[model samples]
Target: NRAVMIGGTTGILGEWGPESEENRYEGAMTARQALAKSKNGATVRIGMTVGVDPVIQLCHAAGIRSPLRPFPATFLGSSEITLAELALAYTIFPNGGWRPNAPHILDRIEEKDGTVVWQSPEDRARQTVIKPETAYEVHSCLVDALESGTGRAARAKFGLKKFPAAGKTGTAYDFTDALFAGYDSSITCAVWAGFDKPQKIYSGAFGSEIALPIWVAVMNAANERYPAKEIAEPKGLQKVEICTRSGLLATDKCYDTVKSSSGESVHKRTTYVELATAAQMPTEPCNVHGEVRTRLVRDLPASGFPRASLAVDPKQVSPITAQGPVLLAENDPYNAVNSTLKPKPPPEKEKPETPSPKSSEETNLPDPTKPVLKAEAVEPDSTKPAPKAEAVETPATKPVLKAERVEPDSTKPVMRAEAVTPTPQKSPKQIRRAEPVHPSDQIPEEDILRPTPPPPSNPDD
Candidate 1:
């Protein structure tokens, strides 16, 4: 089958645009490789091929309580699932395609008087979801995944290599969640590590790195008591030889010709894999690997032949691109980068230059070169009675004395020369301006003197 292009909103699968380099899985791959490497695009394509309805039905049967809708990312596991549900669901592999009912923590309830009030059922058969052969096939694929694929850390880091087990590692977008679901013949376990609020655990966090270690630790401790065992092969499953390069039945033509040290021609064959179960096993022979042909005879060159040789055309190799998964909310990496790198819009048309206002210090300063003019004071008109004194309280600590100073020009009267006076409202200061001294109002300079210093303190009395 030819590979179909699966594009994501992100730069994954070469979705953003055409370029020499992009994050994508370029060519077709067997279902086994797709599962082993945990490729999202391949998994989605596989789900689509199998039909979305069946996949959703399987999810419901597997105990996923979350609301699910048929969409492209459904198989990619965008929906939320609980740790307990996942652990129970994964038991199908070990239980031979049967979904085990969750066991009771307390099998029986006893009263204080030692009477048993209730007890669990004696016999309950697990619900069969698929055939035993199908489970075995899935188990086999997971076994290889642990052996060499993303779940290899269980063997390499946790020292579970000797234990016979099958498992898969799941990493959520941007490491928001990490999970490891695995099983031996007797026990199935799943481990998850993440915060309630989704956040990146850390840079470069993966399922194998974060969750597999915990699963391995628990499994190791349990195996010490229970002992590790292998899953038994069920009846009706057949074993067949298949080509390793292509997961297809092997043929005699799937061999190459090579010369031995003695110059004798020999047939070099590719490695063969022993696969089981008719549903999972290949039905067609591999066309990729075949016997290589070479000339039966060759002409000998003279001794010490020239080092220079004629150039030969390069062999064509099929192209494939390997890509990693991205967060659903993230924009295409290339597009995001290109958008940032794009030149900024020509600075904003130079704003119409606004005239800056002058500072208060500059505007209020008096001109030094101009002559100062004294204010000319004039007498009040004779006909009008003298204006009464108005006592106004000032808000400040000092009292402000306001007087009407009439200018010489008969136009508008120049009013109110404000004089700062001492507080406590006593002995107000009087400012006398030169008012031409009307003949009838003139007083002797001696009479205008201060009232003689209040007769000195009465020491005689």
Candidate 2:
């Protein structure tokens, strides 16, 4: 269920992003399966693995004359080509890796007087582009495409299943163009549907819906004209059963089972045989089921004791018996506590004594240890008689002045201005807002002007 990367980049490539049409994750499909299903992500992965130059060279060898960019997207038909070039390219597969010369408009020209005026050149040598086995492998994949993949409509809907035909269906971006390229033993053909100026043809306009029907119609006539022959499997290619989940050699454990309502078990095989070149044969077995560890058993002489008697019956045992004293006699640290064979009884808790009732007079008496507070003196009656002022003699000696620390009154509010140190207020930090810059603006002038590296070339081509 992991997402596949396109062009080995982390970000999306917009509408050009390669993905499976079903929008579902299909784990570990073989190359043939990828080709048959037209898996864009898988195709790009294979192309990237093989490198851009080699892919371009292979296209050239297949007779594609159009200029192809050395970009990874080219694997998914990002580069455009003419129908003629595509048709010619498909010839190498059915022609056993031999690319035939360009077709002539006329075989020969004859005059009314029965004299041959001109004729097309003969004895043109066909180039060997790929090995026969490689071509056959690709042909088998194309055959799978017709039988079960994108081109299956040709067989299911168009009634083109009688002959052994191999083909592929291609739909351009946004359904701008649709094409079906295929071949049988005798003839190769390609059908394309699109306007000169590319534009959306219609909604859901796949090649199978638009172009395959026409190709099938043409092939129906060709099938009648030429006898159907089986595509021969070339030497050095063999069919090997491989695990669909791991793409490795199938093992006994590489299958699953399902149960039906009737209590019947159905074993679904996860392996299928597919054509692979000798060098491409699987070297390792399927690891998908390797982690299942089986329990091992061994036989030995029976014991003299009865097996039934060895079993412990928890139901018959009492809770006390099941959970006996935690500490044994020998392990007990307190001998006094374990004097009796039975568990010791818990000790009784002490009861608090109640105080005797006191007399009401004693209850009202103030505590002698506590300090007594004196009542304030009442002001003398203002209307009472005033006493004559008496002259008193001044004290013989001056009273010594004593400095005494006085406690602050509890009723009055105390000023703690010095106790509370002023808290320093922190200034808000300034965040410099940087203006958004375009990605192109960040690139250096030299880098922007630098020319793209030339695409690699094949010496053999």
Candidate 3:
């Protein structure tokens, strides 16, 4: 015969994701969800935020050896922990955040043969971390978790009588450790399964399988033996049906969900799946950014193009040029400049001559100044550059090596076997100049340069 009375039937697995926003376990799931899943992502976030130090402090306060020994993962059940010490945290939950004495004896005096070494009251005081209700609320979340959540397998496998149960399952990365902790009105106990070498556990097996069934077995046997009173739902909690899909207040439109489970009715309230299928558009996409806003909202125009610029025709036709006519000092576009009518330099000025001062009458004359300027053009520097220089050939030493010779780099570039620093050709002077327009009539430089992208807004910003 088995040593303990088994209460419930053990069942299969339940996943938390594909439903919850954080992918946490449902209706009853709480911090216990972390333990239930052995979730690294969830536990890491919790331990990082809450600090392992505080949990370790609680562990020590609960009369256990330090749990925060190696690293933060120790807070995450990453390090090895004894079953008895693991239950220490649970003791805090039941005792309203106070550490249990776990005290055995006190005030025993000894005779000649049997001696009593000490006689003093054992320390029994509150080691408070949070209010009693806070611990209880967390305890309640765990209890809810056990009822129909990750620990549901235990409840389904064997029904423990008159004793409420709250607990969690733990599995390590690569199935290094599988553990379960369960507690009732009377006692809290824990179980673990792993080889000394931390070998591979059963395929697809977790704490729910390897450890929790044992927890249920042991806790149920203890409950049957002791018969502790069950904990009723606390006064503060109010139950309301929530949509599984939406995670919101249930609505009439939300329909039922069905999942088959071993011919047993597992009634979990879930939302009706919202289905949207794409259809061919009745109209074309807007040209600006290719959105079908008008198709969605009727207030928009039939064609996505914005209403055309108001067709305004001036009373009198004003000739407009792409390069606007220059503005004069009076801000009119008719300004003109004086021109030099001199012919290309005359052939006679190629000869140098004896310099002579001009008469006052000649100096005062504009035409007289023109002829004198032509005489100075005969300087040797005026010789047009040697045409060969235009296609300047670089020597081997000059760093232009044809295919065979290795060459060093020169400041100037070599192209087509010649060193060339080709001077850039200048742009032609503006034939037509611009005249400023009124700001309201101005077409912005930005419009001429580049257009802006449509905004994030439904109707573009």
Clashes of each: 0, 0, 9
Please give the TM-score that candidate 3 achieves against the real structure.
Answer: 0.42
lDDT by residue for model 1 over 1-461, one digit each (tens)?
Answer: 11223543343332221111133443555577667776666677778889988998897787677777678666766678777778878888888899866644567889999899988876455778778888888888899889887888787878774779989988776557888899898678989889989997974466888899998888888888777788888896888877665666788777667899999999878545565766667766776676432432365678645576658542332222234543322334333211222234577775885655757855565554554455555676768766767888878989788777453567767675554332322333557787655476355443332322346578895
TM-scores of all predicted structures: 0.53, 0.58, 0.42
- Please give the lDDT score at residue 223 for candidate 2: 82
**What is the alpha-carbon lDDT of model 1 when measured against the actual structure?**
0.68
| Per-residue lDDT of model 3, residues 1-461, tens digit only | 00111221122111211111123223332244444444444555676788877867766766677435746656556555566677766777766656555543345677788887666766555566555555666676677567766667776765545467788766665556788777877787878898988886854467777888788778867876776665543344444444444344455545443556776555454432211112211123222222223444356567865676646664333333223222222222321221212234456654765555766955554552233222221223334543332345877577653444323355545443433343433434546688966687455443432223446866654
Instruction: Point out where model 2 deviates above 4 Å.
Output: 1-21, 109-118, 257-266, 290-461
Candidate 2 local lDDT, 1-461, one digit each (tens): 13423222222222343322444446668788888887776787888899999999989887788899999879888798878888888988888889877754577889999799988889467988899998998898999999998888897899885889999988776678888999999988999999989998975677889899999999999888785699788878998999997787899888778787888998878888888887889787777766643332344467843465637684543232212223221333333222323334588897885655767956676655565554443444557655555555668695545445444455765443332333333344657889856685254343332223445697565
Clashing pairs in model 1, backbone N/Cα/C closer than 3 A: none
Candidate 3's clash total is 9
Worst 10 residues of 1 by lDDT: 12-21
Number of the top-ranking candidate, with lDDT as the measure? 2
Top model number, TM-score: 2
For all candidates in order, the CA lDDT equals: 0.68, 0.73, 0.53
What order do candidates take by TM-score, descending? 2, 1, 3
